[model samples]
Target chain A: MAFMIAQRAYIKLYLINKVEQRRGYGYQMLEELKEEFKPFGYVPPQSEIYRALHELVQEGVLYRTKQLKGNDPSVDFQEIVLYHFTDNGAEKAALYKKQVKTDLDRCIGMLHKAVADNFV
Target chain B: MAFMIAQRAYIKLYLINKVEQRRGYGYQMLEELKEEFKPFGYVPPQSEIYRALHELVQEGVLYRTKQLKGNDPSVDFQEIVLYHFTDNGAEKAALYKKQVKTDLDRCIGMLHKAVADNFV
Candidate 1:
């Protein structure tokens, strides 16, 4: 990919976009992104994905809530930390998505015009 | 712009694409690019654009030809240096353009799907 998007930055946007769609755990989001971007030849590394998620949390873009498994009232169950987008995170994610839309439209339009002018 | 392209790298691709479209001088291409990308809010700086062009020529992706203006074949005239895409440059530019088209289609599709799934 000659026009590769910055991986970490893209992952931040991706994280926010996914949480905006549906909140999930760090691992779940990573797997989802890998599957989503794999077809585009851009499945980011697992470590980088985790690092991005942690950074998002640290930067107050996301907050973690502890979820207990097995639905046992008395028994101690494994705790799963689910990531949720903050208000700011959601706002920024929407902005990022809009930016993506604008860029895609621009590039596609220019390329079409170029091809048409030259090829046709 | 949350998803900004790497400027230098992009300039390289942009230069090649422009020359492949039509050969022109360094200044002419810089002006052309400014106009081309201004609508996208991404007209690069003059220095960076020129630097990218120089680097491309140095890298053998482009070749320079000097053109003499004014009618007299033997008389002194202003010499204009034009940048042309080498065979490799044309090939690479075509590849870059194809890459851009692929990315545009992918991002647009994903964003459309995201919007449809979430908004619709």
Candidate 2:
């Protein structure tokens, strides 16, 4: 199901871009994705999400920045890593979008042929 | 690409069913599929095709029969194994068709959302 894979990629990109206006921590994005996919009876594994994020970072589609969490100076603060799209990332995302569209159209055509051929 | 995987399955099933009126040898189906996907800049691998065929056979969706090739009885006849759908396979194919349709609808919806969100 290339479409499903493409859909997952699209959703992940969308969440990363739109989550808090193009910035979100990995766990936050994963949670959001889980919620989004809950209706479909599928919950993405955390490892898979993390792996995808790692890949995006590797591809320069995203950059990671670490920030200190909590405001108290006396307490040990947690480090939170947030992902943001690089300038090149946006262009790549656009290209990916176009590719996904092409793939979608192709799949639709194949499905139609399958149905018409009565061997679906 | 879940859609692509599903499409491959659909195509394989379709080819097996429609090729020469529902009976074709493995290599013949593979060649036909290669031709079908040629315009898309893809050629299904021999291993993948054979694997899919094996799986289908294991699933009882198809039964194989061995036939001798060539016209002369004295000639060393080449054995050709042709695959044909079983009674149960037609029913399974119908169910698979319905599932593919559902998956297609879901993918279309996701793609629309991805585009509408402008993250694609």
Candidate 3:
């Protein structure tokens, strides 16, 4: 009931984008999300992005690797994140990506047909 | 380059939906994703979905709480996951949602404009 909504940038914003990008996780994924959001003309609140990511993990739609304690050697974020898709996550992201593409194609096709029937 | 591709049903589909719906995480989120995909005519591999989830945590994009032991008294999944978005994550998801809605609105408006311009 809740997850259902009109539609938002949130849709293809996260895991789905990563899958399409080949692969990514954590802050790197976040960076990618930002790039994706930019052309769309909005930058998701960093917090909200993190929240969605958090929710995904909680939902088991995503998986996290072991923690890095107080600080990781490489990144300053203090967390050693290694977000990944379970096979399930990958399959789902892929499936959704395909469907969205199909839907868009249909929408475009119908629009063009209507235009042709009426205008040209 | 990669993340910027055809808009898949996968977009406008994930955490953004959950956030727009209010909130959710974990296996529950997976269920939500599944429900979202069903109407589109495809189902993702469960393993893929899980893998995606795992990766998100690894990336630190999503947060995972303490894990339940091999077998918690309650569930059969052998994992107890509590996930929440970090502040940055929440902000980004919210921002992205607004932008997407705006894009869809613009697309809808243009379609109606053309129709009105052409018809009686």
**What order do you get sorting by DockQ, best first?**
2, 1, 3
Model 3's lDDT to the true fold?
0.50
TM-score of each: 0.63, 0.73, 0.35
lDDT of 2 at B19: 37
Of candidates 3 and 2, the better by TM-score: 2
> Model 1 in CAPRI terms: which quality?
incorrect
True contacts kept of each: 0.04, 0.17, 0.00
The residue pairs that clash in candidate 2, if any, are A1-B1, A1-B2, A1-B3, A1-B5, A2-B1, A2-B2, A2-B3, A2-B4, A3-B3
Every model's Cα RMSD, please? Answer: 5.5, 4.1, 21.1
What is the C-alpha lDDT profile of model 2 across A2-112, one tens digit per residue?
322453465555555553375478677878877775655556677767877877778777888987777775695788888888888877766765776666556556545
What TM-score does chain B alone reach in each candidate, compared with the true chain B? 0.63, 0.74, 0.49
Give the number of the best model, judged by DockQ: 2
Tell me the spans in candidate 1 whose CA falls farther than 4 Å from its real position. A1-10, A20-22, A51-61, A67-79, A85-120, B1-14, B20-22, B51-61, B67-79, B85-120
- Which portions of model 3 miss their true places by more than 4 Å? A1-10, A19-23, A66-77, A106-120, B1-120
User: In model 2, what is the error at residue A107, expressed in angstroms?
Assistant: 4.2
